[model samples]
Structure formats: C-alpha cells, structure tokens
Target: MDFTNLLATEVQTFINQNIDSDINRLLLKRSSFPNVTIQEIVQQIKGRKVAQRKFPFLLNENIIFPPNLNLEQASSQSTAEYKAKDIKGKSFLDLTSGFGIDAFFLSQNFEEVTLVEQNPELIKIVEHNWKTLNRKADFINQNLEEFLESLGQAANDDFRKFDVVYLDPARRDQNNKKKFLLEDLSPNLLEIEEQLHSISDKIIVKLSPLIDISYLVSELQNINEIKIIAVRNEVKELVLIIENKPSTVNQQPTTISCINLESDEPEFSFYINEEKTATSEFSESLDFLYIPNNSMLKAGAFNIISKKFGLKKLHPNTHFYTSEHKLDNFPGRILQVEKIDGKDLKKNDQFNIISKNYPLKPDEIKKKYKLKDGGKRYLIFTQSINGKEILRSV
Candidate 1:
C-alpha cells in the first residue's frame, strides 16, 4: 500500500517485536513478510528506536514519526528544555519550526505559541500529533518571509506583540546538502534580522554547533548570549539570543555558556577573551590526564580552563591536560596515570584505550595491541610536548 505517513497499529506491533533485531539481517530475509514491505517495517522500528530517547511523545498511539533525518536534526528533550529555560514570553512565534518539538516545549512557557512550516506533509503530521498530545498551538503552512510580510500587512495594533520570536532555519541547501552559515540558511536570517527585530525585541536562533562563535557574534547584531548545548559530552546545538539594546554605537561582549546534561551539575561558562589571552604551563610527561568534555572543548576556553584549574598542557596543540595533583571540579573525565610507555604496550593485555593527537587511531591501536574497550585501567597514547609519541596508562 502507498504510504501517507507512518505505519498502522498492526504493522507497528509487529515492528515492536523485532525492533532491536539487526536491520540488515531482516532485509536479507525480507520474503518472510509478504503482506508488508520490509522498508516500511524497518522504518517503523528505526523511527521508534530513535524516539525512545529523543521525543517520547511518539510512543503515543496514532502519533506518526517523521524521517530519521528530521528526527536526528530535531532538538532533543533535554536540549529543548535548556533552550527554553528562563525564556520569558507571553507569546512565542517560531518562524522555521520543523517537526514542532521546540514549539511544543516553547508553548509551555508562553501563553500562545505559533509554529510555521512550509512543508505541507510535515505540518500535517505535526498538527495531528499536536492534537494527539493534547498540546495547543496554531500551525501555519507558509514561508517565513511571507509570514512576516503578513504581519506587516495586517497593520493591526490589536495583534499582540510576541515576547519572543524563535527561528530554527533549514540548515540545508537546494541540493539537500547540509549548510553551516547563517547566510546560507533558508530565509537568510541576516537578511530578515531587521524585520524580525521590528516584530519582536527578543529573538532566539538555533545554529549549528560547528559555527565559529567569534564569526557569529560579528555577523549578527545585538546578540547577548551564545549557548552551546551538549548531551553526554557530545556538543549538539548552538543557540544565539538576540535582544534590543539601547546603544548601537558600542557593542558589549556576548556571554558564552557551555551546558552539558551528562553530569549531575553540567555547566561550564566563560567569555571569549578569557579563552584567547589566558596561558597554560607545559608538562613533559603524564602524571594525571584531564580531557574536557565536548561542551567545554567546543566552548574553546582552553587556556582559561588550564590556568584557572592549575593544570598543564602536554603539547600546545593537544587539548589534553595533565597535573601531578588531583583536581576537583574539573569539567571532564580525570584519569590517573597508571603507566607511561615509550614503545608498544608491554604490560596489561586487557585495558581501555584512548588515543589523542597521535598517528595511530583508536581502532588501529586496539587491533594492533589486541586490547578490549573497557577495563579498570585506561591506556592513553599521545604526542608529548617534545614531539615524541608517548603512551600512558591510568
């Protein structure tokens, strides 16, 4: 049968049984299921597996899941909560609201939330799920530029001013290639910045984590804050908050916050200059190695981190730090030096392996040394400050 959306209940139930099974293995024996195509079944299973952690609302019966790519690009539950934190608003407008995940969360903080998506199929799915989830939001199918023009045309003072206007622009180009620049995004946020500011004093735009923080701040005006969102140590999203400032003549330094939801208390923040001018001492060999999580690393506060924490860097380029004394409140994993090796590992056949700024990759090291992944001890391989490949254990 031609599909309009996700699979039916009966099909979903069948998928639930073999959801954890190998997708490739199932495709090999595709003939077993004659009534339904293997592609549909696989899609149902894969989509559900992804939603188990990303958006649990899909667990609800009758709610349809979008393509895996959409799910991958959509904000996670934790990230959405973090982005919406302290987001003061009486009404919210999402210009390029995709799958409606952010809109759903943003609606909780605002009295009224409007999501605009030009894709009819996506909007239809979101509208259906919004009702299923018992969430209220006005869903509109229109281009972001057109929506803003309509607001100007109405010219009605009766229209309530949005406390915050949110935009998560399409990060893909005409060929469906992933785009990284703000100008490359659909609606070219830079082009409509004035219009967006005219409609609302406060604006929040979700950007790629790979964006250069300095470049972003320079290109956009009135940006007050930049938040790097990370989960389980992996940097996921970058959020830029724009506010109306009184003086356009002078620009203030933007606050950069690195937030990780992995640990119990997960926030490491600092200013851009703090990272630039700060300096760290060098260490010849390993005593205790400390590697900051993806969030801290992405924040690019390397020198400030080392100087503030009283740590030394092995090599100028290697971000890994070391210290003779154990330090608390470190933003990342701290491992003690169990052993240091100049050649191939001679002791401890079974140990976890970590290679950083070295010629050999983790897989190659594992394969060559015949070592497993996890153990009580850790074997780290890196190039020292003296430019020698050194191996250390912790």
Candidate 2:
C-alpha cells in the first residue's frame, strides 16, 4: 500500500486529533481524503493507539504500520530492549521479521543487519518505517527457508554468515489458531535447525511461554541456555539460546534463567541438572510466606528455590514456600503471614484473596467466606503438610 497518502500532514493531523475517538463509529463515516480510504485512516489510528503502549518509538510522523495482526504479533518495546542488551555482534540477521520490532532493537549492537520476511507488504512497511527512523538494514522480501537455502551456496556473494541469528516464528497456523510445538510454527524450527546452526554460531529463537522447557531441551540440539522472561508478574516469552560449537562434554547441563523484567525482582538462574538433584523440605505455615514469581513458577524451580533460599515448602504439590525469617533478596513477593481459622474470616471483610492447590478457586473462596475483594490485606487459601490452611497477611 502507498504510504504517501497516510503520511500526509492533513491525514496525520486528523488521526492525531481523533486518537481517542471510537474506531467503529469512525469506520461508519465516509472518507474525507479522496486519496485515502476511511478504513486506511482507521488502520493508522489503531496503529497509533497500539504503539502508545507497545512500541512508543514508532510514534513518528512518517512511520507506517501494517495491519492489526502485525502490530499484535510484534514484541513490546520492553521485551525487545531487554533481549537486545547482551546481544552484540558484527552482523545480525532476523529470520522471521514480522513487524521488525525485535529486529530494530536486536540489531542495535551490530554493524550490519539483515531482515528476511515472507510478507512483502509487511516487509515494505518495516523498510519504510526503518528509513523514517533513520535505521539501516538489508530487508529481504523472501521466505526464510529460501533465504537459508541461499546462504548454503559457498559462491553466493549475496548471502553470508552472521554473528547472531534471531527468529520469532509465527505462532499461529493457517486457520489463525495458536500453535505450541516447534513443528507447527512457520519455517518449522525443527526442519531448519540444522541450517540455522550451520550459518550462525549463536542463534536466538523466541518461543511461546506455554511451550514446555523440558520438551525443548529434549528436542533441540546445541541448547546453551533458556531464558524465561516475564514483564511484572506475567510470563511473556521463553528465549532459547543455541550455541553451535564443539564441546568435550557429552550433554552439558542447560542453564535456565528466570528473568522478571520491569520489576525489582532479581533474576533467578539455575541448571537443569541442579533442579533435578535438588530436594525440598516440607513444613507447615511459617512466619513469612513466599510466592514465586510467574517466570520462576513457569521454570518449575520449586525444589531449587526452596533449597537455595533456605526456605521450606508448604507441601509436596503446593509451590508456596515459608520461612521463620524473611529473605529480602528473594525473587518474589514475601509476605508476613500467619495461619488463621475459618472463624477468623468475618462477613464482608475486604481482602486480596488467593487460592492455590486448594479445593476452591479465588472467587469460590471469597463467596464461601463472604469476603469482598481488593485491599492491602491478603487472604491465602492453600495446602500445607498438615492439611488445608488459611493464611492472613498481618
């Protein structure tokens, strides 16, 4: 699509003025500009609104945005920046640069950058926006598999090896249904894994948080590290780092890093072998209760966390940990809690209810105890070594 009309001073002014306007209502209206359709205008409006929170750097005048799907699939500015911090190399290549959000940031530390994307229109939008932002990259509008094939040619001057290769494969299938397996993703990481390792010494692939870490370790080769990243308390993406190099060790332990970005929580990293050997000591409720962050919980480092922090697990199944004293450096919420009876819960008492590994959900527990939600106080319904217990934050 020609972005000239969308970048017009009058069109941009109208979009900015109506940024907070109703999109559906605007879609019903007729186009004011003969060159641009109302639908196109609405697309820009939606893109601007999304960019406000997702990628604020794209809020420039000449920057063009693709469809809503592209914006939605693109990585947020926070995550992209975090991923780019430690990645520095001479050449960077992004295999599946859907919207170039990750590529734009990940390529910052590289002298040369190449972006390979199958969608011509989306790649054109990225090229235009990158030019507007004064960022330079060799944007190749071709399928990633074809590009990989081109790189296999020793005599092909157009294709060369990169220091680091990044891929955020399309997670959705032809029907727009979300996929969780490596085989299901576009460019099928499993099929291209060999080619990827042959081309770059370091390869970073962003996978869904829902994908099983153990399954990833078992399926992929040259697995150097797996970083589970979360923004605040919500798990965002699982970054799999592959290093293609000769090693004397027959199967080295994978380093798993649980990073809670945008929070004061310190990053928790451990080896898969350590977690396998680590054991947890069970105990009843103690003075302080520790709730693991989403990334740690997703990492399944329950035993290692208990062992490492000198804390005791409430039960075999319940992930909540407790200690007589507080550990300030713990990578999650630490609350001063005491065991309470059901009689202590009065009618209409306001609390932030939490139910974990218990018979009932949070809403059910609230209704059963006749409690109101949202407050500084916390009411936790969970299992202990003794049995089910109610904990109230003091």
TM-score of each: 0.85, 0.97
For the record, the alpha-carbon RMSD of candidate 2 to the native fold, in angstroms, is 1.3
Off by over 4 Å in 1: 1-46, 158-160, 248-251, 363-374, 386-391
Q: Write the per-residue lDDT of candidate 1 for residues 233-264, one digit (tens) a residue.
A: 88888998899766745766787888878575
What's the residue-level lDDT of 196 in candidate 1?
88
Error of 1 at 356 (Å): 2.9
lDDT of 2 by residue, 220-241 (tens): 9988999999998899999999
